[model samples]
Target: MGILDDAFLKSLWVFHLATGSCNNCDIEILDCLTPRHDIERFGMLLTGSIKHADVLLVTGAVNRQCIPRIKRLYEQMPQPRLVVAIGECALSRGVFIHSYNCPLPLDHVIPVDVYIPGCPPRPEAIIAGLVKLIDQRKAQTGQAKV
Candidate 1:
């Protein structure tokens, strides 16, 4: 098995970066960390440090002003880290796509893995994405099929 899979299974820390949002997606991400969602049960954790994170849970549209910071954060994370664009804004810039300050899609800046489709996906969906990441990790490790 490759080392990438081992690292993925051993730890799955999420780093949230709000480029430009209305708080709905942010709240959902927070809810996943709370007792109601019980993200820890699946070995998922929210992290402040990008260096230790395995997943990037990005919310909001990529604002023109925030582009550099977003690029910086993405570059700081380790090679194997995955990015989950978690909102309509993150996926296609939502209603803000043509806004003066909005930067369009998140893929314009960094590579994205899974996209949880919603203006703000539910906490359960966030947890499901985490599980999917774990499964992807396992598959990458050759412990399971893709």
Candidate 2:
């Protein structure tokens, strides 16, 4: 594997973007970072900038006002990017599906690699989704084990 590929598999930097959530999903994201869950041990670090992120962990529904910003963020990420949609809000707008403010689901705004469905999915579920993404990445890069 090349240096970039090795680096990517070693440390997956993530950027969390909240379109318009109720904070439940956001809280679960934090829980993943806490010592109890400690996703960092797997080399998943939450980053503040999209430029440094390997994956985008997006929470909440795509509101009319947030659509452009969400698109901009997705555009800013580097190549080989993966977007993981968290919760029912991002998947199908949850209870806010009827809200006029939320015009579309996340996939409508940007491509999504994985989806974790729940009003607010558990931290374990979030980690599982990330692992799935990692496995997909490995396979795509021809690094998958036989």
Output the lDDT of residue 124, model 1: 86
* Residue 64 of model 1, lDDT score: 89
lDDT of candidate 2 over 55-144, digit per residue (tens): 998999889999999988889999878899999999999899899899899998899999999889999999998888888777877786
lDDT of each: 0.84, 0.90
- Model 1 regions lying over 4 Å from their true place: none
TM-score of 1: 0.92
In Å, residue 29's CA in model 2 sits off its true spot by 0.4
Q: Backbone clashes in each candidate structure, one number apiece?
A: 0, 0
Tens digits of per-residue lDDT for model 1, 23-97: 999999988888888787777788889998888889998998889998899999987778998989999998887
Worst 10 residues of 2 by lDDT: 137-146
* Residue 55, model 1: Cα distance from true site in angstroms: 1.0
Alpha-carbon RMSD to native, per candidate: 1.8, 1.5
